[model samples]
Target: MTAGETLRGLLELTRPVNVIAASVLTGIGAFVAGGVTSHPVEVVAAVVATGLAVGAGNAINDYFDREIDRINQPQRAIPRGAVSPRGALLFSAALFAGAIGFALVLPRLALAIAGINLLALVAYTELFKGLPGLGNALVAYLVGSTFLFGAAAVGEIGPAAVLFLLAGVATLTREIIKDVEDLEGDREEGLRTLPIAIGERPALWVATALLVAAVLASPLPYVLEEFGAIYLAAVLPANAIMLYAAYESFSDPTAGQSRLKYGMFLAAVAFVLGRAVEVVGAA
Candidate 1:
């Protein structure tokens, strides 16, 4: 392939946006937990490992879902013939191994986290993606792990762990909304997504409920001595925005652009708000 095509292939393999979001959440969690180590080398290694692990998961997911992508995301690298399935699979394997190797340089907890994330990725992509309900939960868990991985790297599971868990819950709600948005494509491909199995309205309701739960939970840390006023101030508005988006998603399940963009925005805000909580708490 030409250089440009190769670059695009790599980008597709890496799922750059997801990796960045994951890495940023890790950094934000670490920063908040007062866990920023002076060991730049170790931090760099841990970050790289996180990226590789996320990349590997994306690549492997593409490999396993090549046929599904053919219908839902035909222009993707594997479906569009820009990259062969075997190439993607091998690339994924390499990244997984590289991630584990780099994680080994950090504390044993980081290594263990990497290993668990890798395994979870495999399970999610290979077995859970087509299952109802479980797929959404699995993706949420993986997203949540970014924070836990960071906390583990810093050798503390304290407030960051709870924040990460909350983040995961919010993400799970978003995942359900995404499923509703893609119901037609998923049904066409025989994928048993929650929206497809339960019908869009019920699925949307579940997503909305989850979003409400997240919004309610957003301020609890600050309220119960887990965080301070700054976290409360920063996160409350963001949570309101997320709740608005989730409410809109329920009202307009077919609004694909609205769901995709706004759902993503909510997820981004969750990470930002959580980090804000951490930073304020540290202060």
Candidate 2:
């Protein structure tokens, strides 16, 4: 492979897309936590740290999952021999160390959260990953807590709590769907994932219920006056997309699960935009 190809493979092993999304989440959290005037330097550090942490987590997950990928995702970097397990392990270690180091220069809270999140990610891959709803809930809580972590960095833990709840519920819904999509591979790998534990049909039912609950709560920010019409408008379509992704997964879970990730991304965008609108209106 060319240098560029090698670079791309390494990046893919880190799941750059998810890292980017997480970086954005950190930025939004910083914004909501302190407005524009609070902790600009710290916020930047936090964002970079979050991206690194996510990359590290992804790399480690790939390292641990290489054998599984050989069967379920042969084209992945490790499975395809584009990245060695040792290389991935070292890379993950480096990223995690860098993330913690960066956060350490910020607030104590940022440092603490980064350290804890790093440990949790590692544990999730090795220990908690096989559990059914427990693993799903853990991942969802971690995703949602990114916002709180950001808020904590700025020394403000306000409305982001609600955002945490909303994001967690929605993320859990998507995670359950993903579990369904990966049921076959997980079963072969001896994983006791939610879909495998409760069967696909029941798992889908649970996932769909969570998705519906999130959709119903999507309008809460507007109702609570935490956001304005712009937020409401953007959230409407986001909720629609989430609902469709949830129900459609019942028929073709793999495809629906893929789309649901994008839907969740859209929902995140709407939240950011709504907050932006609130800021602009206030100005």
Compare the candidates by lDDT and give the number of the best one.
2
lDDT of each: 0.74, 0.82
Clash pairs, candidate 1, are: none
Q: Which ten-residue region of model 2 has the weakest summed lDDT?
A: 29-38
Residue-level lDDT of model 2, residues 68-120, one tens digit each, is 78988999988887777888899899999889877887777767778788888
- What tens digits encode model 1's per-residue C-alpha lDDT throughout 1-283? 7768966896888899988878877775565555675455666677788888899999998999899789878989998888889888898999999998888887788778788888989888778877888988988888877878776777765666666766777678778877887777677767888888888889878877866776676666566666666666666666666666677777664453254445445544554565566665557
* Deviating ranges (above 4 Å) for candidate 2: 1-9, 70-84
The number of clashing residue pairs in each candidate reads: 0, 0
- Error in Å for residue 1 of model 2: 9.2
